[model samples]
Target chain A: MEILLAIVIGAAFGAVLDRIGASNPTVIGKMLNLTSLKLMKTILLAIGTGSILMFGGQMLGLVDVGHMSVKTAYVGVFIGGLLLGAGWAVAGFCPGTGLVAAASGRKDALFFIAGGLLGAAAYMASFPWVESTGALQGVLGGKVTIGAVPGSGYDGLFSALPGDIAGLVMGAAFVVIAFALPERLNPRGERLARAH
Target chain B: MTLSWKSGGVLLGVVFFLAVLLVKPIGVSTQFVIFDGILWNAVDSAVVTQTAEGVTSSNAYLAKSDGKYAKAVANPLNYSFVFVIAMMLGAAVSVWARGGLDRAERTMPALWRANFGDGAGKRYLAAFIGGFVVLYGARLAGGCTSGHMMSGMMQTSISGYIFALGAFAAAIPTAMMLYKEG
Candidate 1:
């Protein structure tokens, strides 16, 4: 049941992403170019809709806030984000979406999967060394997510902003960024160029 | 709109109902551990260890990414991986039914054929880096882009929003440098 639900959701998610031209690297590139905000617009829409639902659900006592979230402020995340950006620019697919494209029969997607698996293996094999190295470990020495949130000066042992409020803040921020900001360049032909 | 959210929702509902009613929930990462675990076991049994203190660990850090759509598989009954394998196959069927599949050479640029991509060995390097980075971010942040950013956002996760902001912050710069208007 869980698996079925997951596939259905995943498929819909993939379809939506596909329809919006997310599968196309050019669309992403254009969004980056300061030329178009279509991608940003779509993302803002998704986040906006999602947060609204969450907030409503929380207030109505329909959703479990604790189970609905993950740990926060992971230092490794920052470094990982830096690395992910470099790869997205070069390879054009993240792990989940790469599979989506491959299923869509894009040959490059297959290559992406193979590389991903091998890469995963390689990282595991080298974890001990990676931990010792200055590149990643240096940035996050003994700082685990949720464990070390740099003393907010609040004395409670376990505390975080309520999930709903956080969601509202994030949702509002995206909406502001999407509409307030002008096209970095010109919005011309970005839809056609990137999404193919 | 060409497609109604209701239709999509119904399809998902049906899939979920059926999955829960008969099959296990859809998952994908488990299929990987079969290959990954075996490789780890082959490399050094020492890496796959069970602590007397009851702290279980694998050399393969996939243990970190045991998310809703992904499960932790230590051995046989790696049913989760099996489920992901099924999901991917299901995805293929869905795509094939739509008559939308193509070869990479037919679409992607041969940028590496020149000396530009020589720095990274074509698809090999690109894929390797992509997999490594996405998962690393996923694990570090306690979720993949899907679980952390996409799913998190969908469920109204503040962490997801943070991840998204972080993603754009990084993506905006890199997307500019590597891809020139083409």
Candidate 2:
């Protein structure tokens, strides 16, 4: 039963990823180049909306904080994040989007997937050595929230600010930004030429 | 109607909401880890036994006490594994419906050609290296952008917020240096 639901949801998620041009390396590269804001807008809005729904639900007692998985802060996570970003810029596909691209019949994306699997395997093989390095050691034991909302399963800097309120403000800001940005700019378009 | 970024973003948010309500939060990397476990278990049963014994490294899905691990060891068809397969199937269907299967198969995209020259081998190598590094880094970090940034941020986690800032801070500059227009 859960597998069936996953299939349905996964299908919708994959379709949305493709529809947003995430499966296209050109589109992804453009976003990375800062030549386009379309993908950024989409990501910001999605995260913003999700933040609102999640925190808002928590506030209303509709969502269970216990169920949501929270990642912990670590020195390694910060360094790893930078590396992941560089990889995204170079490869033009994150793990999820790479799957979508391969599914879309991109043979190159298949190579990327293979590489990713190998990478995962490598990490597992070196688990002992890597763990010994203290990179995966969590500073807060894996539960820390930005706002430190009381009763929420997180602790962080902004304890006074309600998490739901923070989410609302962030969501509103993202929505406004999404609205303000144009979808695309044509090189021949007068507005683009005038800016140059 | 063609799904624009605006509509797609809205739909993604809705799907995320429903996913949280119905199941656990959406994550993709753990599915890969689960794959790694299954592969290692098949190639060398000792690896599986060691993981189960907590002698090597502990994985939630490979632990003997975990029901999912039991089901997976019995037959590699746990929920996360199935979800990964379903995600691929979904993308296939979407591409087929949208008539994008052929066009999406290009080996050398314009961006790669512009930045790295038109060598297909070099481009593929770069892709492979990038893939390896990203996945390894994600494992080191305990999650990827989706697992940490999107889901964690939704939960108002400080780690997610910091990860996001770190990612963009590095990604943008790296991209600019590599692909800056002359």
Candidate 1 chain A: minimum summed lDDT over ten consecutive residues — where?
A148-157
Cα lDDT, model 2, residue B70: 34
Candidate 2 docking class:
medium
Interface RMSD of 2: 2.2
Cα lDDT, model 1, residue A68: 42
| Per-residue alpha-carbon lDDT of candidate 1 for residues B31-107, written as tens digits (9 for 90 to 100) | 34346665665676654455554324454354343322112333433444444444455555555665654443323
What DockQ do the predictions score, one after another? Answer: 0.27, 0.58
| TM-score for predicted model 1 compared with the true structure | 0.68
What TM-score results for chain B in every one of the models?
Answer: 0.60, 0.82
Candidate 1 residues A20-50, lDDT tens each? 5455555556666556666656655555555
Best by lDDT: 2
For model 2 chain B, the run of ten residues with the poorest summed lDDT: B53-62
Displacement of residue A37 (Cα, Å) in model 1 is 3.1
Q: lDDT (CA) for every model shown?
A: 0.50, 0.72
Tens digit of lDDT per residue, candidate 2, span A16-111? Answer: 888888777767777776777678788777877777777678788887766666677887778778878888888887888888888887767877
Query: Which stretches of candidate 2 lie above 4 Å from their native place?
Result: A140-142, A149-151, A180-196, B50-75, B102-105
RMSD of 1: 6.8
Per-residue error (Å), model 1, residue B74: 2.9
